[model samples]
Target: MQHSVQLTYDQNHSLSWGKFVGSVLFAFFGAQIISGLFIGLPFMIYTAGLSDKKTIALYSSLGNTGGTLLQLLILLLFIFKYEPIKKLLLPVLNFQALQKVRTYIYLFLFFGLSIAIHIFIISKLFPHATQEQDLALNLENLNQYKILLILGSAIFVPIFEELIFRGIILQFFQQRFPFWIAAIGSSFIFGIAHIYSLGVMVGAFMMGMFMAVLCKKTNSIIPAMLFHMMNNTLAFLS
Candidate 1:
């Protein structure tokens, strides 16, 4: 079972400046190191050194696999040790609230249209370099492992990111800044953290905005996480 602190204006059971800053810094750095090691550093090492087909393929495969596992481990640790979470990790809400067909439709449209636009823009702008790195491996090389990769990308990563973003960052920002400001700022940070490609960064920013909206409207992270998961699932499948 999950435990949460109920906060109200009257009680205002918030952290002191020192504690708040420390907590935010810890989470931010932890996220950065974990995300960077998994996707960033490995990608850099591979692209910077390996030019051969076999070497590139091997490096890419290892990086993606290892990074995903590391990310998953971090997420599990955060969830399991929720008691130590000094700050709100996610916008608290009931799961049943997100069971509406309308919610599903909204999320489907948002994810589908946004990703489609990103793809279209990428194709138009840089058709030659699209998936240049990934193409070295091809679908043939990723047969059995594809399933695990898909699960990590579509299901696991989205949930993990949303929980970190909409749940933790959003709540913290909302306490200090205007709602829109907090949402946009959090989304911007999210986009920059990926630092993959320009197109991917823009898409990530848009995703952050979408998740923020869900969190703001519902006052909970459940809808955002669900929408994020569904979005990743579609990306993985397609």
Candidate 2:
């Protein structure tokens, strides 16, 4: 009877594992769709008729912002639709790893350190050439429409990206894999998605892992969101 009971438990665990993996894939694919749309639409507009670099940039920024919003919407929907799975996610979301005040300081320090590393990497690699063009310049050219770019960059991108990567994808991994595996694996995927440069990739991947860990440590998505927001704000300023 004990052996039979063990077999039943194992079967149920296996089923749960499959479901978790499926959910993670769904979230990943959804983010990709939104992300692609964001990057592609502006290029389409530029190819079709828009001759102005500024106009293209503004449009691209809008796409980036909108894509993020869609990602957040997906996260909410997934959480609502899969309450049982979300329960499994809660522990990862509410990690008790950093209960000390020093941890908060360390978190921000890490954020700053990562940014410095990216800047240095960009300097070494591109040397006199800017890798990713400044979206702000493009938006500025649009004059009236620039508000859209600002809002999208300063708010939308951070919120949406964090929710998709940290809230959904990381948690999805955590439910099935060990903590380190989930964090690193998701971070690697997140880093690769950016396609900026080697330095940028390393910086982004590191940030991704940190954000994932933060989400787990805090047991709340807000911390990661805030961190991402600050990072984006800095990017906009730079």
> Candidate 1 lDDT, tens digit per residue, 1-238?
9999986552574544455556556555775587776685968675677677656655555566566657657765764465434346533644765767766666677666767766777457655433542354354444336565666565666766776677667776787789999999889988886665665566678888888877766666777877777766665456
RMSD of model 2, in Å? 4.9
lDDT of 2 by residue, 1-238 (tens): 4554445542544235566567667766765576567664655666468776766666665665566566667766776667755665455454344566755775687687767766776557655333353432443443345466556766776766665577666766675689899999889988886765555566678789778777766676667776887886776555
Who wins the TM-score comparison?
A: 2
- Overall lDDT per candidate, in order of appearance: 0.65, 0.65
Report the backbone clash tally of model 1: 1
Off by over 4 Å in 2: 1-4, 7-17, 31-64, 90-103, 120-130, 133-147
* TM-score of every prediction relative to native: 0.67, 0.69
Q: Tell me, by lDDT, which candidate is best.
A: 1
